[model samples]
Structures are given as structure tokens and as C-alpha cells.
Target: MKKSIALFIILISVFSLAFNSCSSDDDESNDPQVATGSFEIYLDGVLFKQGTNAEVGLIKDNQGNYVNTVTIGMGSETGIVVSGFPATISDVTTMDNDSDPGVNINVDSDYYGTISGTMTRTSASKISFDGTCTKLMEAQVYTITGFVQSTAWEVID
Candidate 1:
């Protein structure tokens, strides 16, 4: 009877160790993917901004819905940040970056205002962006366009 109890305890310990070792946080293949890429901005069909980096991510909201957030940071005092709540990969969502009807932007060392745009999730690992920003402070109206490639969510059968 003593031997049987000893054997049971050993088995339980081994199983616990095995399960703990199998758990991992380094694997993001099955998690929400984050993507970063480069983009260019054209000011009225002319090259105005270049070498800007764009980052995109999908996160869950308080309502358990996935939301899309995008930030484009151009060197200097220029940038465009937008977010769409409760968005999905198959839906096109509109973002008002400046808390109004436009996107958030900064220029000439100042936060100008917002721009209007559309965000599209092309695939599980890709997104497309299109927007028009009018920086009335700088007297410049430009179009912002770009795409980002995700980190590739993986699924284990």
C-alpha cells in the first residue's frame, strides 16, 4: 500500500512538469499579429513625405471585439495616427484620427488636426490604407496610402 501511494505521487509530479514545460509565450502564431512597414505620402500628387514607418495592430476591446489601430510616424514633425474600434479582417472601417471626422496628424512641429481615411484588412497578414489629410495649418492637402504585412498568425492543428 505504501509503494502504491509513492508511485501515484511520482506520476502526478511528472505529469505536472510536462504540462508546465509545454506552455510558452514566445509563440505569437496563434495570437493577434502586429505589423510594421514603410510608406510614403504624396502632397497633391507630388512626393512630399518619404521613408515613413507604419505600424498596425488588432486588439480586443472592452466589448470583446477586435479593433484596428494604425500609426504612421514620419521623421520630423509629421505623422498620422488612426484607430478603428471593433474592426475585423473582412470589414472596411473608417478612422478619425483627430477625434473628429479626420485622422490625427502633426506637421511643422505642431499637431495640426485630423484627416479622413479608410482602412482595409486585405488578409490575415496584410492591410491596406487610404486617406486624405488636409493640414490647414500648413496649407497642404495630401493623400496617404500604404500597406503593412503582419507577423503571420499561425495555427496548430
Candidate 2:
């Protein structure tokens, strides 16, 4: 009777361990990453600005293409604007600068450049992008690198 009781206790312990090992916590880490309405900009390999606010405007055309405009750090001196590019993305489309020349960048109303990299629509209301901007200011060339993950977007008529 003592040996049977010990064996029963051991089995229960094993079962408990097995149940706890397959928890939902492990599945949480496997979930897909989403945007959190934040962005970072680097100028010439140096940290320029970091912000937690973003605005995105999206418009869909008759042909089912999506046009998006994004603004980060709005109303601040260290702002960035992206327009005309990512012009044909859908809910899950990814586009690069090579295929889309319509992407323009304006920084602080002073630096102007064109974007070169990739922009992806992670969801219907979110986008993630990493790009380099070759800015020209007074005949001087500067490099600006940025990454944006916006949490929400508005559909425009």
C-alpha cells in the first residue's frame, strides 16, 4: 500500500508539471509584433529624435490601391513627413523605393529628401517601415535613417 501511494503521488506530480509547462505564456511570445505608435530617426548614424505620436492618413483608389501619408512628431521642430510613396499598398502589402518613386520626405520644414527602403502594411490600420533619406540642404547632402511603426490610421475619402 505504501508503494502504491508513492507511485500515485509521483504520477500526480508529473501530470501537474506537464500541464503547467504548456501554458499560454509561451504562446504570447510567438504572437506577431504590432505597431505601438512610435518612431525613431537617426541622422548621419546619430540619434536625432524619438517620439510616441504619429498620424497616418489612408485613401483607397477605385483600382483597390491604398495611398498613405504619414506624419511623425507633428507640430515639433524635429518632425518627419512621408507622402506619395507606399501608394499602392493593401492591408498586407510591402513596397520598396525602387518600385515606388512617389515617396518624399520633409524634415523640420528644412531638410528635404527622397526615401529609399521598404515600407510594409502590417495590418489595415498599421504600418512598419525602415528607410534612408538622402536629404539635400543648401547643396549639402545628409543621410537620415528612420523607422516607423504606427498604431492607427484613418481612412480618408
Candidate 3:
């Protein structure tokens, strides 16, 4: 009878250990989360503002190098796209204007420009830009400043 009781207790203990080891709370997802944020940019005195329509994440460039990008109003005709950033940014990183342009401003999908200024990574999920864009064809220039705060960064292929 004692052996039977000991065997039953052992079985119960094993079952308890197995159940505890498979806890749902301890199972964390390894997938990259989608980013969410808002941004506003003033182009030639015209204001373009979007709420919850911004995404900041890491994407691979043409050379397969990881670069940081912030896209606002992605699906809309008028938006702002800033890319060519290093995989990791410092307090205030200047925008590069070499062969690989760093910033692209799309106004009504008509005007495109390159930015000359600095980008600040305030936090892990927040970034701010302060600079000016020079229109491609025209000699027009305007101030472009904005900030994006996202819950997380979405890693894009």
C-alpha cells in the first residue's frame, strides 16, 4: 500500500513539474512588432500632418545593408520618407547627401527633395528630424522638422 501511495505521489509531482514548465506566461514571441506613430512636416509653407500613420523601422538597402527609415503617410500620395540612416544612430546624426540620398520629400507625389540637417534618436522607439529640403529641379528650399514616437520598430525585409 505504501509503495502504491509513493508511486501516485511521484506521478502527481511529475505532472505538476511538466505543467509548470509549459506555462503560457513564460512563452514570449520573437517576431518583430509593427510600429505606430504620427508626424507632421511643413513643405513650402504647406502643412502635412498625419496621426497614427507613421512607421519607423529597420530595412535593408539595395546593398543589403541594414538602415533605419521613418515613413509617414505611407499609403497616401503626399508623405515624407527619410532613409539611408545607419543601423544605429547617435544623439544627433547629420543627414548624408552623397550618392545614397538620405531624405526624400514627396509632396502630392510631385516634388522630391533631399534633406540637409540632423536626425535625433530620442529613444528606442522615438526619432526627431530637424532640417531643410532642397527641391530637386527647382531651387526652392524649405524647413522640414518632425518627430515620430512609436511603440516598437518593425523589421522589414
Enumerate clash totals for all models, in the order shown.
6, 0, 0
Error of 2 at 119 (Å): 2.6
User: Root-mean-square deviation of each candidate, in angstroms?
Assistant: 18.3, 22.9, 21.3
Alpha carbon lDDT of each predicted model: 0.45, 0.44, 0.51
Per the 3 Å backbone cut-off, how many clashing residue pairs does candidate 1 have? 6
lDDT of 3 at 133: 68
Q: What are the per-residue Cα lDDT tens digits for candidate 2 across 1-157? A: 3532353344334333323343345454322211125667666778766777443333335695534554444333544444443423453233333223223334454544434555555454444545555443343434555555554343421
Residue pairs in collision within model 1: 29-154, 97-103, 97-104, 102-115, 103-114, 103-115
**What lDDT does candidate 3 reach at residue 127?**
65
Q: After superposition, which runs of candidate 3 have C-alpha atoms over 4 Å from their true positions? A: 1-33, 44-46, 55-58, 61-66, 86-90, 98-101, 154-157
- Model with the higher TM-score, candidate 1 or 3: 3
**Model 1 lDDT, full chain set:** 0.45
For model 1, how does the per-residue alpha-carbon lDDT over 65-147 read when each residue is reduced to its tens digit? 54354344433344444444223566676746443323444455444333567766666654555677654445475676655
Best by TM-score: 3
Best by lDDT: 3
